[model samples]
Target chain A: MSTLISLIVSGCATGAIYALVAIGFTLLWQTSQTINFAQGEFVMLPAFFMLAGMNMGMPFWLAILVGTAISVAILGAAFKRALVDPMLRHGALPLAIATMALSIMMKEGVKEFYGAEAQPFPSLIPAIDLHFLGATISTQSLGLLAVGVAAVLALQYLLNSTSVGRQMQATAQNPNVARILGIPVERMVMYSFIINAILVSVASVLVTPLYLAKFSSGETLGLAAFIAAIVGGFNQVRGAILGGILLGITDNLAATYISTQYRSAVPLALLIAVILFRPQGLLGTAEERTV
Target chain B: MSITRKVSRLAVLTLAAGFMAAPVLAQPIHLEDVAELSGGGATVGTNFKNGADLAIAEINAKGGILGHKIEITHADSQSNPGVARALVQKALDNNPYVLLGPGYSGSVKVTESLAAKAGIANIMGGEAAELTQTGNEYVFRTSFGQQSTMPKVARYIAEEIKAKTVAVVWVNNDFGKGGRDVINAEFAKRGIKVVADLSTEAGQVDFAADVLKVKNAAPDAVFVYLNEDESARALKELKRQGVTVPLIGETTLTGQKVIDLAGGAAEGALAHVGLTTDAPIPAVQEFRKNFAAKYNYVPDHNGIKGYLAIYVIKAVTEKMGKVDPANFAKTLHGMTIRAKDEPGILMDVTYDEHGDIDRQGFLVEVKDGKQVVKTILPKMVP
Candidate 1:
């Protein structure tokens, strides 16, 4: 039981991180009708930026803010504006390919500058383990969980209460109708990119202490979160969160109980099952199309 | 007029033939080195290049190999197996007398056969167990084989540390898994209980769950076989979980990058250091000083192995008086050289039947941010 409890605590901590990444995928899909395949790179790049900023003698928290702001304001917004938005007009396929290219370019470019070794990120929180309910949890894990949950709640509040959120939702539902209603659909899409970048930055910064920042760090993460987005509900923000958490928990449980050698297979199996049985995902409604 | 013209034409033809023959007779010994300088394996590749460059410089200064100046042509594998293969093809086309690196196991494995077929002596630093099993005479290693390093590590864990039980955690890859198997076999021989056996995928960052599992097992000590990044992350996680079990790391932990990445968490971490930077031995101290003076940085195990590769090649080739690939293989296989016989950071360097080294590695402990050699193990038998 103690072992099970440990697994759950760690699993949930990782799940929270996955949830944030999934939210990045879901937010972009909802507003822009295109998935940013480079969502993971956005998460990885900011950690590198944060490290660089800290190395430059900036305060830790201030470095994080500056790094995250660059990822959102400059990297994310400029990328979407210059490349993604233009390609998106042609179709989702073009946009996706472009995002993948961006992902590769971003990873290789960082690798070229930083070298291929994993650079250690300074721990934002002190290394303290708290034992509760027969489980030992690190302070970093607890902090990540708290931050992730808060971000999710804040996102919910934004979507449910804010005028911009409603406008974003209107544009997502029908761009033509939303444009007729003077929603500025293009701006909503741009905002979606910026918002996703912020979420990605937060997720990456939180996890870097655990993983260490590296060129390949974003590859597995991006793929896993993309799968979570599909499994939860491709177009639903809340579903993506749930999907990410579920995948994380399942992966940890499988590693603990089944076999670490086969743990990767578990999430992939879940993805296949979800695609076959519920193509629209567990929480997603099937799209109604008129022939 | 016709006889005189014929004699002039014969003279011209003789001069042209002599000119062509002169270049071939004076052709210098060409060595090819390809390593992952641009991609994932760049850390090891960079060190390998530095060490190789230093060794080549020293050898040339003393007097070129057999009075023929040795020249090295290098290529970047980009840490990709496909790129490694292409580079091997390129090197073979150049028809170098010898080849030096291409570090990662996968890259070495992909190109080993090509080197064997081409009959080029390709000295590599990859430690995967299967690398020497292919019966490729052209393939030689300057580093420990996976099988060679683990037995000493297991002995250190069991006899020296006096750990009754050990938990094994290794990366789920050819190199890591091979080391794990050797550790298990060695532990079983010593009657130490193999309490927990765990594996993690390559490039894993989060070790909370994995470390917790090992903690739950309650082993006296933990043996880890992983790459630089994973080793650092695992060490940090172990510290975070308050698992104070003595963590015995493989040679990968001996690298400077691992210590730097793990920081204070790596204190008291014991590892089988291939070449200790702080060895009191004059040769090791000299190597450390020379490398630092040249590169403006401390040399790691990877760098030392690169230096050893060139040193060994030079030692064997000088005795031959002529650089020939087939004769070089025979010479490397037949000879057993002591630490005094050849100038290297290792003790006794000998190639076994499988082309693996028989040198015994030193056990080192991390003390005050330095790798301090504790003791050298017994000479390993072939």
Candidate 2:
């Protein structure tokens, strides 16, 4: 049916967005065991920065470049040095709590500086439609899907096939072993943070078209990414993608067939079911702990 | 000179000076604006304040209402009910003659009782039907209530568009919930079958499935009752799915802001609105220009609400020949102020005893990212 096709097509597109944010969360958790609680804020801040740049008379592309440049410095080195490095000694829980504080600060900071009007996109993607089986899909949604998947694929290539990828994996598996093998563990961890920042900036751009630049958008995205990370195991690249697609599809299908009020309930129930039945996520591997 | 004579003369001088020097009549008429400034309802509250400010500036420049300058103080409600209560209580202590706003319906619902108890008129921007239903005589609305507009919408669907079946998609909030209840009641009265009834959350991002449901149900028309941004998102989704059925809603659907946000998705979306800046009338066009000049952005319905409320205060107090806080509410009830009598009201309006407003409304469709008025509905009262 056309309804089924529309549900799947749109679901995959939305899933692609959630997957992008979920993978960024996975990378931080894997590389340094650092939980960046302010992931949502990181996602929201770049759009405002781009807005600021445009307001300052920069072209749209230049504004994005400016936003990326600032995000690279602030979200990467400054974030690790200020919040993660000093607090990693305390434990992951404290770092998470700290990120929670950072989240509130960034949320308020954005509101105080930029007024709460929903900033629309600069018509980056042409408004055109592609139809199939009596189901219509916009070129914008398809573009977002393509960009999201391509970003994931490119990240996968860097992680699985490059020397830096091997070193990063070594650091994630065992920092002491990586250090013994003459790989700079700290530097690999920094690379992961930098990559995390870049990924989030990309997400902010993709989401702004459909979602608009909003202050509370981060909170919703932060929650969605967390849900996707748990549903897909934190360990596998494709697992995050699978989890995002399932989440998006289930959300749409549930709203279609079930009560719309209960749309969110079904995904949360799936999360609980996943936790109870498969402790290690749908695609995540269980660790063998040695006493 | 006699000591008694000197003392009596000094006392007489003191009494005369006291009588002539201070009457407190020259003091400014105080009005407090308790609004949502920093939370989800910021856009609504901020625009309301800006509109209020413009009216105050205009009135003050022209020597004010009743020759006493109207001064307003703005308090941020933070979009929370509890915070709004505290701020209303604080404003009451200052003893304002009028309370201007808390544009959000929920905030207005909580704070209206406080002003009602204080016997001060609470002129507000909330359009929730239940707000005036609570028998609060002190509460006055600057916008259209659902009870006033929904029947007209149902009639339009039943008569003009001649739709037999309808699909209702509404936000699950106080305002949207209230609208849904009224429109459903109206639909039932008209024998229109509701094929699909969908409830969406306040900040829901995607409406793909919801739109699909509407498409699959093959309703003759769809009603989208949602908040501003959510309405745009829904419009976008509805466009993406290529749903061809006529889209109908209240002012929430075809506002200037929604048209801009939804872009071309808003074309042909019809709505009946009590106040719109896009009306071809010169008065409203002048107001739109002034508001944009002041705020650097086009004002929404909330701005119109706040602007008219201040003019209402001026009209009433001037009619009474004095600022009587106790009699302000009684005077506004069942009062008709014509547009020719007071140009600041922007349109002729009549107030019922229950504090609901009836004014000229527009049935418009979004054309080229603007509302083009298809028809003008006359006021309920002649």
Candidate 3:
């Protein structure tokens, strides 16, 4: 019982990290039909930026702030204006291709400049373990869980209650009609990109202590979240959140109960099953072609 | 033809033959190094390159190898086996006398046969046990194979710690998997039970699930065998989980790079190292100082492997009394190079017919961010 509880607790913590990144994926897919393939690399870069800032005598939180600011200015606003706008003009496929190229560039560029070593980052929470309900949980895990849940709730509120979000939803549903209704469709996409950046930045800071800041770390980190978003539902935020948690727990349980060698295989098996049986995902509704 | 033109053509022909025949008159030795200078294996490759370059600088200053200044052409493998094979082909195209490189075992497995076919010696830093098992005579290792290293570690766990149950955490790659298999066999032979065996991905970030599983197992000790960065993350996660079991591992687990990344978590971890900068020998201390001075970072086991590859070429050539590429592998087989004779070799090393190496090693414990030697295991032969 204790072992099961420990696995669930740790797995959920891992899932929360993945969910934070999946939100960005779901948001972009909904707003502009854009899939940022560089999502994982984006998370990795800002952590290094924060490390550079800390090296230059800034506190950890201040370094993170500076890093987040730079990401907003460049990866968010400037990226949309320069590359995303031009690429999306052709279609989402072109934007996806562009983001894939951007991922490689970010990986290689960081490897060239920052050196290919894992730099240790300061942990956000203390390294204290507390026992609760017959299970051992680290303070760091609890801290990260709280932050991730809080961020998700805040994002959910923003999308459900705010006028900007309503307009964004209007643009997502029918960009032509939203523009006709004076919704500023371009600005809605811009807001989606900015929000994606902020979410990844938060995710980056939360996970860097465990992953450390390495150039190749993003490859797996991004891939895991992408799977979560797809398995949960590409079009719905709640589906993505559930998908992340489900994959996380299943992964741990598989490792513990099944063969360790086949632990990764089990989640992949689930992914294939979902794709085959329910392409619309667990919580998603089947959509009809309107053409 | 005019008599003057005929005589000039004759003179030019004779001069060209002389230039080809008297190649020994040239002051430089042509060598090629293809290594993983960027990507996943970048840290290993960079350290190896720096170590090789340092040895070259020192040797050139001391009147060169057999009176020929060593000149090495370095290429990047990018950590991909295919890229490494392509680079090896390119290096062989130059018809280099020796090939050095590709610290990655997968790269070495693909590239070593090329050098063997070309009759050029390849000295690499790959630690996978199966790398040299394919009967590739031209490939030589600067570190011990898992086959050689695991038995010693197994003996330690059974006798020293006397642990009946053990847990093994390994990266699911050629290097880690190879080591894990060897250690498992060793443990089985020694009648030790493997309670939990956790396999991880190469660049996996979260170790919470892995750690929790290990904690649930509640083994007497844990064996970690992963790449440098992943090892650090596992250590950090293990510390955070407050697992009080002693950690034991091979080279990468307690490496200087891992220590730097794991911060305080690496302390008290024990590892069996084939080559470490922390050896008590004066020559090793000097290597540590020179490497730190040159690269401004403490050298890891891979660096020592790289430095020795260059020194081995010199030692073998000098002993053979000629720079003979065709006879290089044959000469190295069943040959022993003594540290007393050539201090650059660092330790007395012998190479068998299969290209495997035997030399002194150390069991060290990480103390205060340093690998403090616990005991020096004597060379396998003497």
Candidate 4:
């Protein structure tokens, strides 16, 4: 029972990061109808940037902020010029190919700069355990859970209450129709890309303390998030969070009860089951397309 | 064509021919080295390269191996088995007489089989027990097998530290699993209770969950059996959480990265190490001084293992007075070299039919962020 609870707490902490990355995926897919395969690389880039900043003696929080800003700016420009502009002029495949090439180049570039060694990231929170019920949880885990919840709530507010949020929704629903109604559809999509990059970057910074900063971490975490998005229902934000948490819980439970060796198999199994049974996902509405 | 143009063409052809023929005149004996030179295992491979280079330089300076200057071609396998096989094939096409190796057990297993089929002598630096059991005859190792070291490490922890209840945490790979099994068997023989046994992936960074589990179990000491990065992360996490049990385990703990990452947390950690460049042996000291002069860094066990492996090969070859592959194997199995005056090249060198080394490990403890050799065990002549 203690093991179960501990796993759940830790899983939720990791799941929160996954959910954030998945939301980035959903945002891009919703607006542009194209997935940024380089989304993971975008997430990873900020972590390394923050690490580089910290190595240069900058404060952790300052480093993270700078890293996030840099990644957002680079990702925004790249998406606009390299992906969006080309796709608008040509077609979707060119953007897809460009993103794929970007992903490879990003991975190699980071590896070359970082020298393929896992560097320890300074912890934001003190590493101490708080006993709850029978399970002991670390401050980092608690911090992760808080971050995940905060990101979700903040994103919900941004999408519903804010002007940009309404603009993004309008653009995502029907760019042609929204533009006909005088909405800046192209600007909204660009804003969505920038927002997605920031969200992923924030998630990367939060998780770096736990996993340490490494070049390939973004890809590994991004893969998990991608699965969570599909399992939850691609474009549903609430479902993405729910799916990520559920998958994290399933992974931990499988590792404890079934086999530690096959812990990674949990997300795939859940994805298949979700796809088979609830094609629309737990939180996704029936009107939403099952893509 | 004009006579002047023809004469100019002949002059250019003659210069190009001379440049091409210069390489053929020397015909350097190219020896291929495949090891993990990057990622988590880079230190191991880098050390091996240092030692191999030192030996190659020494051989060339003294007169060359078999009247041909020694040249080494290196490839990084990154501790991947598939990559190791590809590297071996790449090296074989270059027609090297000897292949130095794939540093990890998994890579060695793949490379050794390939080398055996190709009728090439492989000097492996990895200490996996199964590598010795291959019975391939052509595969030679200067390092003691994991089977030999595992029991010794377990005994050291149980008896020296007086830790009766222990937890075992290891990577879910062949090397970790193998070491864990041996340690478990050894612990059981001594009637010690294993409080918890856990496994994590090789490249995993976050070990807080695993560390929490081990802490909750409340073992006296934690036997961490993973690679350098993971082990260091585990140690740091455990320290941060105030879990202060002594860490005891494999040679991976001796890596500089582990020390750098763990900092003060690694001070009391006890680990197994074959020989450092600072060993009391005179030859080892000489090799150390020379290596430091050449590379500007102290050599680790990986470098020592690689250097000693070639030294063993050279000694055996000298004894047989021939470079025949079969003779080389026979001499290796029957050979014993004493670092007698130096006392540290290896406590003593001997080998069995399984290619198991007769060398023993030194129990080293981290003192002031450096490995201080605590006790040395004499070679167990099997």
Best by lDDT: 2
Instruction: Give the runs in model 2 whose Cα sits over 4 Å from its true position.
Output: A173-181, A287-291, B1-28, B38-40, B63-94
The Cα local distance difference test for each model comes to: 0.81, 0.87, 0.86, 0.75
Residues A112-211, candidate 2, lDDT per residue (tens digit)? Answer: 7887777787657786888988777877778777877787788778889999988998898889989999999889999999998898888888788888
The pairs that clash in candidate 3 are none
Off by over 4 Å in 4: A53-66, A83-101, A286-291, B1-25, B37-69, B206-209, B212-220, B240-244, B263-267, B275-300, B303-331, B337-348
TM-score of every candidate relative to the true structure: 0.89, 0.92, 0.92, 0.84
RMSD of each: 4.5, 3.6, 4.2, 5.8
Tens digits of lDDT, candidate 2, B42-146: 777878888899999999999898779999999988778789999999999999999987887888888899999999999988888999999999999997888
The TM-score obtained by model 3 is 0.92
What local lDDT score does residue B282 receive in model 3, on the 0 to 100 scale?
92
Question: What DockQ does each listed candidate score?
Answer: 0.48, 0.66, 0.55, 0.31
Q: Report the candidate with higher TM-score, 2 versus 4.
A: 2
- Candidate 1, residues B260-327, lDDT tens digits: the string is 88987788888886666676677778887899999777877888888888888877887687777778
The residue-level lDDT of candidate 1 at A65 comes to 95
Better of 1 and 2 by DockQ: 2
**Local accuracy of candidate 4 as per-residue lDDT tens digits, B1-382:** 8999999999999999999976444556667999887655666777787788888788789776555677888898866788888999899787776789778887887778888877777888777777878678878786777788888888887788888899999888777787888889999998888998888887665555677678778998888888877878788777755688788877778555577667677888888876665456667678878888997666667888878766676666556665655456666776676666223344567777767777756777888888777887777753
Tens digits of per-residue lDDT, candidate 3, B284-366, equal: 99998999999888989988988999999999999888778898888998999998999999889999987899999999999
Against the native chain B, what TM-score does each candidate's chain B reach? 0.88, 0.92, 0.93, 0.87
Error of 1 at A127 (Å): 2.3
Q: Give the alpha carbon lDDT tens digit for every residue of A1-291 in model 3.
A: 877888898888788777778878888877777888998898898898899899999999899999999888777898789888889879778898999999999998998888876778788788688987877787777777787677768777777889998888888888999999999999998998898888888888888887778887788778778888878888877777788888888888887788667777877898889889888777665654210
Off by over 4 Å in 3: A285-291, B1-27, B61-63
Predicted chain A of model 2: TM-score relative to the true chain A? 0.96
Docking class of 3: medium
Better of 1 and 4 by TM-score: 1
Cα displacement (Å) at residue B326, model 1: 4.1
